[model samples]
Target: MMMAVGVAERTGLLETAVKATIARAPARLLPYVVAFVACQGHVMSDIAILVIPPLAALAFKAAGRNPVAGLVGAFACVCAGYSAGFTVGALDALYAGITEKVAAALPMGQEAPTHLLVNYFFTASASVVLALIGGFLTARVLEPRLPEPTGDGSSGDEESPTTEISKEQRRGLLLSAAAVGVYTAVVLVVWLLPGSPLRGEGGALIPSPVLSGIVPLLFGAFVIAGVVYGVAARTVTHKNDVPKMMGESITSMSGYIVLILVIAQFIAVFNWSNVGTLLAVKCAALLESAGLTGFLALVLFVLVVTLLNMLISSGSALWSLMAPVFVPTFMLIGMSPALTLAAFRIADSATQMITPLNPYLFLSLALMRRYEPGAQLGTLMSRLAIYVVPFLVAWLAVLGIFYAFDLPLGPGAGIEMP
Candidate 1:
């Protein structure tokens, strides 16, 4: 996925898509459009953080608004709405694997959900709602409070004169889209045919080979689209370019690879010592005694995670440490591991702007400094604080609605244990 996304980015396919959306948006709707685009950035992973802000600033400047506000608002949406997206991402797969492992250790009667789409229904809906909230805040609250961009909006750095999509880029995007569309059609045909090999026993689609093999499917789709785009855009002049790009992508993930190794050891020890089960049993008993076993228990968990997220900015590290304990504790109370994971995502994402530990917050500040040289860290945090209350409140309300109706979190995954 990284290799493909990198190739698409290098070929300008991603930037063209973003620019096309912004270029067509009306002045009054720019905030919402930018916000939606930022939320969609999760599909491209961290690249969106670096790509969206400056482009958004340019869009705001074109629309006669404060470019700095545009940059800040887009950055906030990308970070705070990180977990919410229409399409499942690598993070979803990562957390699902962890949830499956922790739940498996607990002897939960029902099967634990390891599917990437386990939280799809909730997070996908949240993506749209959060985008709307981001848009409103950017237009009504954020822009008015932020100072106007000074000194010709250049930020003392080399700025692109325009965001116009080049002819080569447009052609590459067209070819990429076509390639992905064809690839998807072929996959669907193969999977949906009568007596398809992708199906499980009795032709069950949920636990089928197609669903379980989604990672490879996604990888193939992205690689196909990216390579097509790169070739058309003249970015991949030789066949070896694709392999080179893949190697570079893997190289960039060295730090995360090391972190995962440590996390694996920690989880192994956590399971072997039986401390996780003991802590879970005691915590479950306490929650049950306090009459906080359901909605209220989940609410408290969200709050705790929100607070912890401010202190520990790495989502993967935090989830790795917490999942062993919380997954089982919630399961003991008859809640599904998926639900526990969903609550964690809400708290983890919503407080990102206020977390000083978030390395990306510093990246955002540097980007803002390009437009506002006098912008202080305190000022940025204060302005960002405006987003915390509304985002948290609105997101919790979303969870409440989902809980009240007992909606399925994803395919064959519910709000409670079977």
Candidate 2:
């Protein structure tokens, strides 16, 4: 995933795509379009936090709208939609792996499946809904409150130049898209054909090779698309360039890799001590005694996570600590790990923009100042705080609808333990 994103970033495929989308949008629908694209920025990871806001500001400026509104809206969407996306990516894998590990600590009668798409159905649906909410807020609520950009260049002494997609970039995007299509088609054929090896016993698609093997599949697709884009865009003239890009990507993740190691050790010790299981049983009993063993308990859990997120901006770090206790405790109370995970995701993301602890918040504020010049962090926070309630409300609504209908969170993963 890192390698693919690196290649895409290197070839400017991702930037070109964002620019192209904004270029074709109608003036009135610009916010809506920007909001939706921002939600999809998970593909670019942290770079999205840096890339989307400025581009959005520029696009809004071109459309004679408030550029600050565009900047804030994109930043809000990227943060709030962190754990929600139509596509399975690194976040899904990280959360799923941790959930699976902690879930295994408990001696449940049945195994809990925590594959890459464990929350796929819920998140994909939430992505669309959040996009709409983001767009509505940006267009009707945020833009109207902000002043128009004067291009006074209080910060730069000159107006920012307009962004454009070059002919080569257009060609690269087209070829990369075609590459993704061809790769997907081939995979579908291999997985869907009769007597396919990807299927499980009795030909079940769930618990099958295709689902379990998603990481490699995603890696292949991304690499193919990115490399194709790189070649077509003239970013890669030699095969060695691909490996160099991969090396650079891995190097960039050194800090994250170290963090993961520390987290892994903590989890291992927590489980080995047998204290996690004991705490979970005791906690579950306490919740049951309080008659809070169902939806109410999950609600409280979400609230707690939301508060903690303000202090600890790293979702992985927070989840690593919480999952050991909450996941098994929820499982004891008849909730599936996936259901508990879904709740954490909601709380984890819904309040993202309001938190000062987030590194991205500072980055976004810096970007905002590029246009607003005198804009302060507090100003950015206030604009972003306006987005929290609507995002939180809409997210809770979706969760309620899914839980009430007893819908599958993902393939073979329901709202309750079997």
Candidate 3:
């Protein structure tokens, strides 16, 4: 899948993958599937966010730009927590539970993220939008101002625009749309009307069935439709052309799957070792004893969180360990639960853009190779200061604003009162 995605056209390739993810789900959970998956790991991070590195690579590759920050940011967003927005899958349950005050930190807190959990859709979208802007800035400004870094992706694969969508392609699109629309209609009816045929039929709380065999439904729909359209439009009359297009997606993803499974095992082993628990415990003590408290304490906490995130990659586990003590402690000092959580998130999210312990950091390095060719780890780090400096300033300034005003993060959230 990795290589195929690397070579495939950006626009259609993601559509194919998105459909594949949905097509693989079961029918019972179809309602809330799209929004679920789209917002799935809504809290903690998930592997589905993995798509960022490749897709971000494609976008920058197309624009003739640097992909380091894009890929790193994408990976960091997923590994840390689920709110990074551009992707989703498992972090939702984990994050939701943490903020709900359920589980304890891996070591001390009663919850996983121990810190305040962020609203997924809100944060995730921010990551995507910010990443695009960052990438754009780097391509248009930073790349030219400084010495170019080394890279690992193929610059030779320039995507020239197609002259037009052939009739057959149009037909395929219509089919794809119809199939998705039917699935969507079912979900919305159930959610809004509540008396719809599909409502509460299974375990689903909401009806908007958007996935499950639905994605495969889209895969089948788009491919068949594309083929039908191809034949009529003279773009693909032969069986051979159809297979060739479909084959591209499968073959390219194979490497990615292999890498994912291996990483899964490594993470599993790390979790089992209780290292995260021990580390969070140790860090919590140091911070507490240092006598950090209230808003001033939060500044120190963020600095530490950002520093630790560089060494350990799991954002949920890190917060899980820290939030319990800090949240209640900060609350006692007049800070809001929501604001406390938001601080940890900013710190956690910031370091991923440049940290080394993150595994995907390597993948992004490879992406950089595609553009700079001679780009190295050292080089990427040196150049990142440009984007990071601005982002840090922008990111923290906003956080400072929230703290000063004692803002409300949402319902049942915010700073203190008299």
Candidate 4:
């Protein structure tokens, strides 16, 4: 995750490409641009919130629209869409890793193999759903409620350059695409070809190299694409530039690293205490005794997670703590680990926009204040709650429907365990 963001920042590939894409878009397509920026949150949620909001604000300003609507809409989408992404990335790998470790503690014959793509299908669907919801809310709700800008839509800068894509950037983007295409082709051949080494024993896809090794593949692909783009665009002049950019990227993520370490220690202590397991067993037994199994149990679980998200902002940390208890319990109650994870993701994402504890909330507020000097955190929260509330209801409804249908959460992953 750090490496990917570092490469993009160092090469200026993301910013340049995004600006270029926005520049070519018609005014009517500005809402789509906001949704697109929100979807990028799937890459790295915190980073996306920081990077995309300002750009979205600029895009709204350039279109002579309400900058507040653009900024808040982008922020809301990033928060709500954090759990859904088009491609598998670090978050998917991290969740799978935690699930694997925790599942090992389940009673011997009950444990299931934890694949990285366990929630891929559901999340992919969620990405599209949330994007459309975000676009609608931005245009219909947020924009209408926002007061018109008193000044020219610029954020204190009257002389911002026009959004344009240069020939060099175009060539660079094409070269990057070509690099990704070649790499993807190689991966497909290795995994899909008969008797290929990437496939598991008996040529199975599950528990195969492709499923287990997605994170490293993502890192390599992003680095390769960034390097190719950088060279073609003249962003990288010498051999030393690559490492320099990587180092800078790591430096920028120091705060996140510290947070991870603290959370890691907390998880370790929680596990050693055995309290999470005890709680899970008791809760599962209670729910079962109370006839709260199946869809009702799942709904209750989602609501619990949603409330927890208000106080705890870190998804990985919260999952590390909760999965130990919830995964096994849910399995015992007839739900699959993948379904449990899907529910967690929906709940976590739905509440992020309204959570005051989220680090991005502070950053977003700061950004908002720059545009509207009188912007207060409370006021912003209330406004964003409009989007968050409906998203929560709609998302829970989606989850309930998914549960009622007994749909597959991913390839070979059903809602219930046999």
Candidate 5:
């Protein structure tokens, strides 16, 4: 995540492209463009919130539209899309690693080898669902409700500069795209070729090197793409600039890294004490006794995670705490580990928009106040709740349908355990 963002920032790939796209979009489509930008939070919520909202505000202003609802709507989309991205990235790696580690501690843990793409299908689909819903609400519901902007069109910040895509930037973007294409081809060849190294023994795809080594693959692809873009874009004039950007990115993430370490230790302690497993067993037994062993229990579990998300804003941190208990519990009751993760992701993401503790929420408020000088936190929260309520209800329905139909959460990852 840090690596990709650092490169994007240095090369101006994300911001410049987004501004250019929005600039070209029809006035009536501006809201949907903002929604699309916000849905990109699936890639990096922290980055999306910081970069997209301000640009969206600028777009709204240029289109002679009120920025209030659009800005808030973009924030809402980012929060909702945080759990699902178009492609697998660091968050997928982190969550899957945690799930695997926790699952390994269970009695039947060895039967369920965690794969990087465990929730890929569901999450990728979820990205579309969120984008569509957010765009619809922004266009049909929220925007209509917002009052006209009264003050000067300034967003309290200095006006955004005209962001014309430079020839060099275009070349850089194209070259970066080429690099990614080549890298993806190589990966596919390595995985799809019979007797390839990435394939498991006897060429099995599951439990293969591709799944287990996906994190490094992700890192390599992003770093390679970033470097190519940076050099082409002149962001990296010297070789040392690469390491400097990486260092700065990592340094900026010191707080999050520290949090992950603390949470990792807590997970370790919990697992060592056998508390999570025992609790899972008891919970599963209790649910079974109450005739809530399947879809109903899954729905209840999601609601519990949603409540937990209000207090704990970090998805990975919360998953570290919850997966150990919930994954095993779900698996014990005939649900798959992948299905449990899918439900947790839906709940965690849907509630992010409403969580006061979410750092992004405060950041979003600050951004909103830039447009509406009088924007109060409480008022914004109340307005945002309008979006959150429907988003949650719709998402829960999606989850329910997914559960009831016994959908595949990902490739070879069905809702039922063996």
Candidate 6:
């Protein structure tokens, strides 16, 4: 239905509409082996978020000469979407342990906003670095050498510049720039600018200057930018069309929304059950008896978190279960909870994109198949590894060095937050 509508909208063809509707074809059409392999339940992250990636990828796919740009663009969108941090999605779980530990009783869960900078500054920066490197590798290395048409939507031999495509690029870039600029400025004020609105009342304000604002800022930015870009890109033309595009975006997101809602509820329920707090307490107590140095302890904590990620896909759940223990425990060791959490986060995040259990990975693979049908999990992983590997190492190194120096992750954000 979606592919069909998109094809009709693009080609203005009615007869081909029925055939065009199915892109990769539904799971029912997959070969028995593929279906069996895909059923492993590894992909558990909230998938509704995929809407953002495709929206961002739409222009790139239309304008780029190769699959590399399109893939990078999609990842960019995913990172930005992750920046939102609401929806009790994968990210929320990751930071919940730290966030709630730092600032108790988070009124903001999935529906409300959280400060993205305080909790997610490191993640955001890592995301940008990864995106740039991925884009470069795609454009310079893969685009020029990629093989002929093979994927579901692969049109290697039939490339052409369309006015619509040009228009979308112009619109998307403009909207993306404006949105990112606004978001950056907000972070600057809260973290860099003195007397920023969110600056805590005084010293006791637990990482006073930098409050939780980045995620909401990002969410607002992307939602607005997506709408504006849709109109400016002519993907949507009329004022009325704006609503329709949003409607279309939301309509396409029913499945993901449902999943995230459950995820959110599960998070709240898990917290209410006090399971997370108990687990954190027990772990922290056990670790305390070890007498490791602050840095060594943090390093081990991060490794543990990374391994935990393989078993549990929910970042929020994991965090909720970890922060109470790690943060206070680290604080006792003369380390900041924020820093401790940040270190763990760096380790936890770099593996998500590569994990087989991540549902979004499958979506990415599906999209990749559109450009190269024969592209399998291993092939995509190999291609992604080149950039992702560098990113992981660079990011972890920067984070470790940053925490060791007791640098602020952002304004009012600091090495220590009781």
Query: Each candidate: RMSD to true structure?
Result: 1.8, 1.9, 11.0, 2.7, 2.2, 10.7
Q: Model 5: per-residue lDDT, tens digit, 47-142? A: 777777766766777787877766788888878877776666567767887887888778676677577888887777776677778878888888
For candidate 4, lDDT tens digit of each residue in 1-418?
5677578667967767667666666777787767765765666535667667777777888787887887898888888878886766667767876776666565631446467788877777777777778888888988888876554434454454345667887899889989999999999888899998889879997668886677677788889888998999999989999999989877877876786687567656656887766777888999989999878787788889899999988898789778888987887777788888888887888888888788778878877776777778897898798888777766667777677888777766778875
lDDT of 2 by residue, 1-418 (tens): 6776777777677888888997778989998888888887877878888778888888887888888888899999988888888766677878998898899888782487788888889988888899899999999988888865545323465455445877887899999999999999999888888789988778877778987888888889888877898888888889899889888988998988998898889889888998888999999999999999878898899999999999898899999989999999999999999999999999999887888888888877776776677788898999999899889888888888889899999988888887
Give the range of the ten consecutive residues with the poorest summed lDDT in model 2.
152-161
Candidate 6, number of clashes: 25
Position 395, candidate 1: lDDT: 77
lDDT of 1 by residue, 1-418 (tens): 5665565656566777888887778989999999888887877778788888888988888888888878888988888888887765567777887788788877672476657788888888888888899999989998987776654656455655356877787788889899999999999898888799987779887778876777788888878878888888888889888888888877887887898899888888888999988999999999999999989998899999999998988888899988989999999999888889889988988898878888878878877877788888997898888888888877788878888899988777888887
Q: Which runs in model 6 stand beyond 4 Å of their true positions? A: 1-98, 101-114, 128-152, 155-282, 370-372, 385-389
Q: After superposition, how far is residue 381 of candidate 2 from its true place, in Å?
A: 1.2
Q: Is candidate 5 or candidate 6 better by TM-score?
A: 5
The candidate with the higher TM-score, 2 or 4, is: 2
Q: List candidate 1 stretches off by more than 4 Å.
A: 155-162
Clash list (residue pairs), candidate 2: none
For each candidate in turn, the TM-score is 0.95, 0.96, 0.52, 0.90, 0.92, 0.58
Model 5 reaches what TM-score against the true structure? 0.92
Estimate the lDDT of model 5.
0.77
**Superposition error at 227 for model 1 (Å):** 1.0
After superposition, the stretches of candidate 5 with alpha carbons farther than 4 Å from their true spots are 152-163
Give the residue spans of candidate 4 off by over 4 A.
107-111, 153-163, 255-274
C-alpha root-mean-square deviation, candidate 1: 1.8
lDDT of 6 at 63: 39
